[model samples]
Target: MTQESQAAEANASGNDNLLLQAAAPLLNAVVQLRQAVTHDDPAGLRQSLIDEIRQFEQRCKQAGLPFEMIIGARYCLCSALDEAAAQTPWGTRGVWSGNGMLVTFHNESWGGEKFFQLLSRISQSPNQHLWLLEVVHYCLLLGYEGRYRGSDSGRVQCDAIRKRLAKLIEETRQPQSESARPLVEVHPLVSSISRPMIPLWACATVAALLACLLYSALNWRLGNDAEPLLRAIYQTPLPQITVGRRPSSPQALLDLRQRLNDVIAAGQLEVSDGAFGSKVIIPADKLFAEQGTAINPVGRALLARVATAMKNVKGTVLVSVFTDNRPVDNSRFASSYEFSFARARAVTQLLQSQLADGHAIRSEGRGDSDPLLPNDSNENRTRNRRVEITLFAAPETLSNHQGTQ
Candidate 1:
């Protein structure tokens, strides 16, 4: 064989080596995951799956393979884990609540199976890299389940993942030549009609139609119709819309919730939608240093940032604070309720001072009433003690409904 053939064979062998390096760990992970599932050990299953993912990631980096391969493999592994989770008892498949506590996975069935199917289509196609990048993005968004979205550390990790995926996509993108279309000979009868008999008249008629459209558009832009038209076009802060005589929160609030989710997810907070409005759940420990109403420096800074986020929200801010099941000494505060109430009041004061337009701020203290996680461990107790601030667009409906009674 010639030197050129030898070189081609060597390159093909190197490609095979890389492929095996990436696939071997994934295959082993799958086998171990299946074994864990067969034994019905949720903890073991979760651990093994995560281990395999890490191993695969390491192997990919070492092999210098494209990120799309890793992403595709990750999707498959996560799907397998989800399936195994289905077979396990519902209570056993727990989520790692960013604060070291294990919380119940709220929606176990929302891992984008349909979206994954669409992604799988790119496996054999030349554009697999681009499509897999999209898959990575979709998976990242899915990982933002209600529980993890409140974690600050979680947000940072997600941002890092996004940056890495973007870099990989940029590196892997391929340029394609535009496909050339075959020219066809025009049919004689159609060709004869194509050259308009009154060319000037045709042009004049088209120009006249364009002028009418331009005049109508200008009139709409300059008149009372402009505001509504523009609002329809660039609807950012979505105004409230009526649905069957019931008014819903504006789209702006929904968008605001997403924005808040992104920010608070980076920190040790969680964002959720409640009946009243959107809410941010902050751990009580983070807010107050051991057993005191005085806000710590960290807590104050966090609240200040939260206040800034809420400044534009035209709604009532409700700061509901709670304590864990542990008993507090009545010497410092009369009762747990009082301590919680005091904490809420302090936060409310800060928000009220910052919020523009004199937005109403409501403070509630429910001592040990709600427990997010079972108070089994110190971590669980820490998670249980939290302050949830809920924001509603407007309280007019609430007031009106109360007035009739």
Candidate 2:
């Protein structure tokens, strides 16, 4: 052989070696991607798939082969991965079109025999479109057989495989001479392969940014100044009511009760002797009636607890305060219900201050209408001059209709 022929052979061998080396990584990436998908790691799988596509494209470029073939392979692999991840059982014996456009697989009873029968029909067909379909069919059958049985026994099988491969190679080759337009348009393939990754990355970035923003907002809202309020809310002072019968799944009710207890405990709210057992009593003087004192420590503590309890509690917690009528100078009751209502409204305002979101509080006072005992005695009157908290079940609950009192 001439020196030129030896150099050409050496270059060809080098090119072949490069192609093989490039293909190894590309093939390994595909396998890793499949494994990632099987393990249910979508992020890992997506990244691996993207890397495989990039590597395959790069290798195809280096080998002087049309990247369209690699693109077609990527498309098929992606389709298969998607189907597998979705748990769709794809049959082994089938025909997949050149562009992975359509797939026809052998169902039960239709095996190699049926595949050969279809091939015979295609061979007899006159139409070019039918002939192409036949070629696709044979190619798919060859792939299927290779994948499953690992055999190529039939006389026509080897020929079919060669023809199908040749056809793909021919389609991939760029025209020697340029016409009005480019022979092979690869821009679409590049765009089609890369377009999905952009959106995936963008969505991931947006989600991460949103998560950070939400965390920051929460931290800022619950800073140092809110500690006293939160503490007062969490440990309220209240008498424990060990009701003989409690609901089977009283988690929601218990949470509310605990929060109220925390507030009562922290505030050290004292109850005046009389009324049904020991109920909390707020002195009218230290209440909202005093211009400077919007809410006493006890009242503030109670309000904080109410706010926290209501956070998880679904229903409305009605709070009402009543004032003493027997005072010699009863100027505060000149407006009667209105003065009492103002006190309730003031408590609601304190509760609102502790809440994160702007929530409306429903409150009303009926003067001394629903007194627990007669106002004849000082002790009985003290009981009447107090705030009452009633927890009504949510409107949506079926048991809410039952009378609690």
Candidate with best TM-score: 1
Candidate 2: pairs in clash: 235-262, 236-261, 236-262, 236-263, 236-264, 236-265, 237-263, 237-264, 237-265
lDDT of 2 by residue, 44-129 (tens): 54456556655655655555543323333333333333332333122121221111111111011112222333333333332322
Q: What is the lDDT of residue 68 in candidate 2?
A: 28
lDDT of each: 0.53, 0.41
Model 1 CA deviation exceeding 4 Å by range: 1-251, 395-405
* Candidate 1 lDDT tens digits, 1-405: 433343234234323234333444433333333344345444554566566666766666565555445545454445434533443344233442110011011111223332234233442353545534444443343332221233446466456655665555445542422443232222333334365576898889988999998866643333322222222222223223222222344434434556556556677687776455678889988888767888888888888777777776566777888788676754545446556767887887777777787466767566666567888899988888999988776546445544554
- Best lDDT among the predictions, by candidate number: 1
